[model samples]
Target: MVTGTLDRKQERIIAGIPPVSDFSGIYFYTINNKSNHELVMLLDSIIGLNDSVLSDWLNITPRTYRNYKQNTDVVLKGNVKEHIVLLLSLYKHGVEVFGNTADFEHWLTEKNRLLDNEAPYSFLTTVSGIKFIDNRLTALEYGENV
Candidate 1:
């Protein structure tokens, strides 16, 4: 992690954002690595599904997929199912994976990018949440082609 007050010289992204917290790199890349054409496209292209697809899928026109790109907490509010689906779809196809919010936020801070995702103001990561999503959740149920 960068230190000493944002010197603003070496402005480069430090790491891959798993595209999510639920799945680790192993699981995330495994799904996307398959020979699935749709999955491949999702990986190479930065934001896979645009706002329209998410809104259409979740039946919410006012919302945006860009909003969904950050922490899962806020996105889940409008429709937990949709938020989770987007994440699973991304993880299953995306090449990288972030372990948790700390890792994601660290990247944002280092890159000096706008941190806009609406994570709950007081959200805290927990062991159970990680375990549940990683080991217990059914991948296919959430659009993970794995």
Candidate 2:
């Protein structure tokens, strides 16, 4: 295991909630390192998915999710960390495509007729789902009416 402390800058970058447009470099780096539970909390604050739902997305029981939150330095498993990063990236893309975070967040929760009245939020449980959403965002970005 790679054991070390994250300097304030590194923590700031990782905990920046929805990452900015040039976040791919940092995203790639974070994928290989373990993340603190605070990342999860920050993500929750922005997405506002309750722990129960978020825990399910993380593929862990609610109890384990709570346990993770208790430890500030807890290192999330690789898959969990990757899922978080991808979610962040998806949100970042959403914000960019929609021109604001609020609209993007609204779009995530609101059911879309194009998607057969299913809220895009329902697909956030897996990495493929995140990618699928990202692709949809790309379509919107190009004015393809997705």
Candidate 3:
């Protein structure tokens, strides 16, 4: 449901992805695909996050990520893979709710009154935090005050 324009590569990467609400589907994808650095970088680019932020979110050092990127055979741990899947799903949902990637990125970087003046980007490191952000987006979409 991404309303924002995506490049052909991004579209192909996201093609056939299920909605975020489909936890089981995402879980299956994560388990079966066993994420590599290439996929992580693709999702990070689509979400407009830099390598530093993505490394922090994944709890991996930048050097480690670079090494992984260089070694195509290297697959991330299951937890990291799951987290990446959740992040991409959240990014898609955010774009759909905000009508475009730029607006969603702005919302993510800005401090929110509902979050006690914390930017939404601060919460991307954890799955529960991502869900909280998702709930906030849903509230806005439904015209409910959070």
For TM-score, the strongest prediction is: 3
Q: What C-alpha lDDT does candidate 2 achieve relative to the native structure?
A: 0.69
Cα error of candidate 3 at position 146, Å: 5.3
Model 3, span 100-134: residue lDDT tens: 88899899999988889999989988878877888
TM-score of 3: 0.84
Structural similarity to truth (TM-score) of each candidate: 0.23, 0.73, 0.84
Better of 1 and 2 by TM-score: 2
Q: Residue 79 lDDT in model 3?
A: 82
lDDT of each: 0.34, 0.69, 0.76
TM-score for candidate 2? 0.73
lDDT ranking from best to worst? Answer: 3, 2, 1
Worst-scoring 10-residue span by lDDT in model 2: 1-10
Question: Residue 98 in model 1: shift from native, Å?
Answer: 21
Tens digit of lDDT per residue, candidate 1, span 1-146?
A: 22222223211211232434434652554443322332222322333334564344344552443454433343234233323334334333322334443443343224221223423111212323333333312452466532
* Candidates ranked by TM-score: 3, 2, 1
Candidate 1 differs from the real structure by a C-alpha RMSD in angstroms, to one decimal, of 17.4
